[model samples]
Target: MSAEFERDGTAWISASTGTRWVPVIGLEVHAQLATQSKLFCACEVRFGAPPNTLTCPICTGQPGTLPVLNATAVELAVRVALAVGAEVAAESKFDRKNYFYCDIPKNFQISQFDRPYCTGGGIQLPSGRFVRLTRIHIEEDAGKAIHDRGDETLVDLNRAGVALIESVSEADMESPEEAVEYLEALKEIIRYVGAGEADMEKGQLRCDVNVSVRPQGEPWRTKVEIKNLNSFRNAREALEYEIPRQIEAYESGDETRFPRQETRLFDVRAGVTRTMRSKEGASDYRYFAEPDLPPLALSESFVERQRGLLCELPEARRRRYREELGLSEYDARVLTAVREVADWFEAAARLSGRPKETANWIANDVLGGLADPKIEATSIDELPLKPFDLAELIALVAEGTLHSTGAREVMGEMLRTGAAPRALVAERGLEQVEDEGRLEVWCREALEGREQVVADVRAGRIKALGAAVGPVMKASAGKANPRRVREILLRIIGEDE
Candidate 1:
């Protein structure tokens, strides 16, 4: 902690000489709405389109063009509010947030000013820390600025006027880990509610991170805004880098350089934040009611209907997966983090008549084979593997018909062809060797080969039994029922005495 240099409008310095500083973060997330049309125009909200082709007079800010609110956009915004337990306002209005950029042809953005549609909600992270939200408001997105082809910046209006919901959070997050968790929790919530895809790379979701360091137990002030954090990893990285930068600035006794409240651009390549511009206060926006659009009014029935549309959110699913299904918190969180994954797991759990085993199978086996070979399945549609087949596969493992290794091979074939687990097992001769005589022969043969291990086990060195099971399993090509092989091995070993 360092002493405050005599005053400013919003800057603060630590009162102590050397107390440790901590970061406080708040996020302003702009998530594209899950709609096909733009917020004010009927332009299709499609990405990767020809430049300016998706634009109409209204979205292009042409003269005599009036904007009409997209009813679906408001409902989507309300859905997000209700999903996060925010209070939905009966009446909200759009305002002209004046600004100038190459992408915004109108030189202003239609956004919610004082009366946002939804206010007061919070998302709880996996660590159980709840980051409070300020408001969720509907807005129209600007066009894209393509800077790649030559020096002159080109504007593409394909994404212009797209529907977006801005979620502003309170500065409750204290560390980089907490900030990343908050972002992930927000992304999961948006996906769960069917609000948006929330993929950062595709520009479906974007974040502006407000990072500031305060002495322990000090109030927040002099926070710098890092703009356009495109990914959660980058968001975490920005915080990790910026928090220390500010602390060092404060420690350097440079009053003029540090503790300035301004917006900085996160240089993704260089991994540093450079000054973009001085941060604007609310008055700088000159927000006023949009004369073209009327005040948004929602019927009580409409709000209730949207509320009913809220399905089992990720957090609730997480709790149910852990409490009722007996899954570990880590496993439950992974399964429920994606809605389709949770849906698949639940349906499979019921079909297989086993909860925990199904979860383990999905988390460990089925999910591992989804999209990337290194990562596991996160969604049902990621592969040809069906939930019913997954359930049947788990049942096979549970009933001791397929050994663990054989079950994995069966699941692999199931993902490849959408074949029934039983069919694959039978086709591959994967049924566990349950015949006592066959297992005894394999066990005795293993004993004949590994007399040293048998001697060790017979002398009460039970740990050596693991060494003997492998030979029996190998002899049976991994189709041997491990428990039965162990039983037969003990029988053979006991006779060796």
Candidate 2:
């Protein structure tokens, strides 16, 4: 087993049979741009078009069909770059990445080499750690290959020529947890900026994780690359599994003999990585500048115009929620977990006159119930209660007109009947019973009925107070204010003694 040491807030595992520490990680995330057309072709970039139905000669890479760059893609790329604090280059160029795959009819991919469109961006994690971004480059995705169980490999050109932004980050992430966090932060930015759909399950976002293991106080070892991780959990699991396997190889005195660079594929069901092939260096791709498309040029005014349209990203919004809204970290995180949820909370808070209480109910009560799998499938906008309706409910709770239990009932009624909060409270008589004299009479009757518990309370068993409170709440059909019930119980017990 490899010894583990902490560095850069991440645990580094030692190579086998050596004192060398390996802290290996890098990420390549592919985000499918939500463009109406493909990168070099005018064909529609629809997902579920029939096989080869959406193809044109330009996308199919027919001879003499020169590729043209899409201007809108450049603007979207800049927007994503600005959202993540990246520096946009005034002039960026595209290159041809030569490779041969059956799915790629062109036998070459048009992508950016060293001079990418955007570079040197960093995303701040929730833990205040910074994950450095190496570059964000635009490229056209190749078609996909599907093999049937019995016979032949089939190719689908529907996805060919689709626009994709390959966002590469440095080997700065330390742990599987941080890796997921980085992916999530990037996904949120892309989604908020309307750059991509960013749905991992739909293959809109895919990751390639580079992992290596070394001992403490040592340089990184030769790293292995894991590709096509479809989900964040798979990315984390692949790293978790690779770290130990690599450590064991080094610990068994095989460091010098161990293969340094290789490509591995993660098997989600089997939970292991099998060697796919040897990794290739940059020279192997024979990258060269594209002749058909000219270099991209951006004016200062154009870049500034795109930046002006950018909204406050999730991290900034989260900070404002904490500072301006006076919400706890947990509450702010919950409220800002989704853009829709945050928008709804802000709308409700504006009308409720109780910002903190409105946030709490939305984050804890409303979102908590909506987490049910069935409810999650349905849209929140389709629900009966509007944002102002939720605000009204919170207002009633703050004004002491509804007990906590009664508030839940009123909320449920609002969902079912779409009634106003005050109207529901009045119609159902769900208001809390706060009349102290009436509560006193009910408490005395409860004490008389629970003779044994009353005797225990008089004998100094103060915990029996809950017993009396429960009966009072039950007597009032859960309408009694619990605080008032407690007060009446104390008074009744004192007078009896």
Candidate 3:
């Protein structure tokens, strides 16, 4: 595990194994495709519809009904593959993964096996470790069984046959934090290309994590698969408990008593992983090509155009913000995490022609007011304030026409009315008091009120300048420019001599 920690203000305690053992984690993320229909059927793919209402013979596996590929689903999958710099196989096919379950009405899932849509790419986590990807395959989602009621279990088939893209990562992550980073980066890429929303809480994105503990610099231990984690926090909490639990088990028991590789479920209430079933190998599921579906092929031109759909991804944008615009690494990451925010930031940066200043304003002023950092708004135009408006606000502060504090106040109003910064400043009387004559009056009042602090400054306690500045700001009703206040304070304190 990297020693650098990025909790983003949350208290994320590290998963420790007494410093002798390490946890190897790999994640299988399934993202629901953003399409209007299911993968194989034309039934309307709407969530919250009445249970079983969206089912049709095609999706329900009526014997004579055959499956057909959804063209939109495949293109979206290809876009996801390309966004991560994966190689999109020119030819791919759907296979039948046989598994008997209530959710899988067909008794088999149409999935990609042996040859997937794309393979061999990786995401570089924020910790500078690149988590390699095994493959990204297309598949159909199964329905859900609502078992919470007292007696009866109801089946919801609305999600059945919905298109999904499963991305598998190699066991490269060494800690819980790295696992979260890899998933976050993957979700960002999927969302950047308009492929999927990747909201885990809404069941739009699901994850299965493979966790194992091994002695430092040794061969693999028995790997446990934590299945169907709905949220990143639970996944992380599960690892924090599971890793130490396994280490304790190994230390306490003999070789035969140690826990082996198996499938487990993350108990959100208990904050631990409990065994669900023994983990199965690939042979357990009989895999064969779906006879109803034909091989999927794409032309070279079509593939190129799909590649052209690629915009600047989060990683690239973060790097550009850091290297080209001179933003700190933290600032860059915050700005580019959302494509809409990045687009707005780039426009503001270009208009203001000041990258660092614009970045500071957006990071501190704009995103701070958001209800969610990962906001679902699709475009900057949907935001309350436009990009040019942000640029104008930055320009006002830069020209000393507005104090930084006053700019923040104007920003709060801008978000409500989408008003221009200058207009808001005028209406609110927030313009900085740049005139030296008026500023002198405030400074003299500050000196009289804080005579002891002024005496301390004259006696060489220069840090007391802060005390003088606050009183001046208060006297001016926060309209005074800090820079001018300091100059007048110095002149009054005889420092000009």
Candidate 4:
């Protein structure tokens, strides 16, 4: 592949034996806010609530039923903006996007067009590149259309007026990897802030991809907007399909045949972008300021108050885990991947007073066993072995009172029987055997029995050391401190002074 294809913000396309290039991808993702009520109505925003059972007069578009803004929804949007490092505008307003659809009872969506609530933010990927955010606007979602198998379309007013945030980004992305990273980062920030569930499987988060390509050092070509991509795989597939199709058309010397200013749908199963309709510009919507609701006015003091309530975002928390707690990058990423897991780690760390040890066990043992549903039912707070109990077990290993292998057995027993760590260790006689005399006798006998391993050890074969330790541990039934066993064996074999 050419360096131009690798770094010039273009998608590399391989055809048979050759490669082509396409440039510049951007995405717009809409995440539904997690407010209990709809954006402009009192109707409950509960999912799966028997079709239109949650609808009210205002949401159903009854005459003389005026809409009211949900304060919680507005606050949630602002919180999400703050989490993503967006600037909160002191004043923003809504507009009417006129359209006709079976799902939209009002025939117009209340959205922000000219001015949005927040703007100018960015999300950094693990690769250290930033995808600049253009704006995050507040809007009201339309209703849902349930089409029956018999060609009958039923409208459900339940989803009407639901709060949603339209997160638009600048065309700064260069590849599908960057796109996925941006989406992951955005989802993490939103999840941390309690803004929305952002589950693409549930349609709570939807993404539309905008892609255009041009030769290196040239201006971009006409862009095509692909809509209704539900998953990250579909997003990448859509871009992949579109980039080649456009390049093929352009290369055929048919500029007029290429897609011009149109909306397209990604056929996930077929892996292609199909024409939906001619894309409508903002002017086509005849957007005008909403007449009913007053402009949303937020005070600087109010924005500062919201900022004060913001929690440390995932990136910052991950950095603290690495810098302050001295955790490995992989460990830090695993712990801070979810807000709940991060909280669990912090609480366990504090209680254990052994941050690294607690993190290790949580990452290895606790998380490994999380698949058992019965174990999952017990909250971390209610676990039989408290963080301190595990800390005590770790202390034993660190102090050479218990072998690392013995500590593991004690931990397994603690999980199964809910017994105290120290008590279990005592009752089972699982303490490390560190007596110099006792270990020396065992080592000498082992050296006589395994003459070949003893010969190799004397010949400076360090790998044969494990050959000796393995039998010693087996003879001790896994109770001997491994470090002491190694020390005694080395002294007898003359490998130690």
For each candidate in the order shown, give its overall lDDT on alpha carbons.
0.84, 0.84, 0.84, 0.81
Rank order (by TM-score, best first): 1, 2, 3, 4
Clashing pairs in 3: none
Give candidate 3 misplaced runs (Cα > 4 Å): 1-19, 372-380, 495-497
Tell me which of candidates 1 and 4 scores higher on lDDT: 1
Residue pairs with clashing backbones, model 1: 367-376, 367-377, 368-376
Q: Check candidate 2 and list the clashing pairs.
A: 16-250, 16-251, 17-251, 20-215, 21-214, 21-215, 22-213, 22-214, 22-215
- Model 3's TM-score against the true structure: 0.91
Model 1, stretches more than 4 Å misplaced?
Answer: 1-17, 372-379
lDDT of 4 by residue, 1-497 (tens): 11222233354654542445656788899999999889998778887788889888888777887787899888889998988889999899999999989888878899999889999888888878888899999998888887755679888888888999999999888677777878888888888888899988878888998988765556887889999889988888787678767766665578688758789999888988999999998888989998888999999888787788788899999999999999999999988887877888887788767789889987887665554566643445445555566777777777777887878888887765567787888998888777778777777777776878778878889688888887878888887777778878888878542
Candidate 3 per-residue C-alpha lDDT over 230-309 given as tens digits, one digit per residue, 9 for 90 to 100:
88898788887777767666766588658787998998987778889998888889899888889888777877888899
Determine which window of 10 residues in candidate 1 has minimal summed lDDT.
Answer: 1-10
Query: Model 2, residue 233: displacement in angstroms?
Result: 1.1
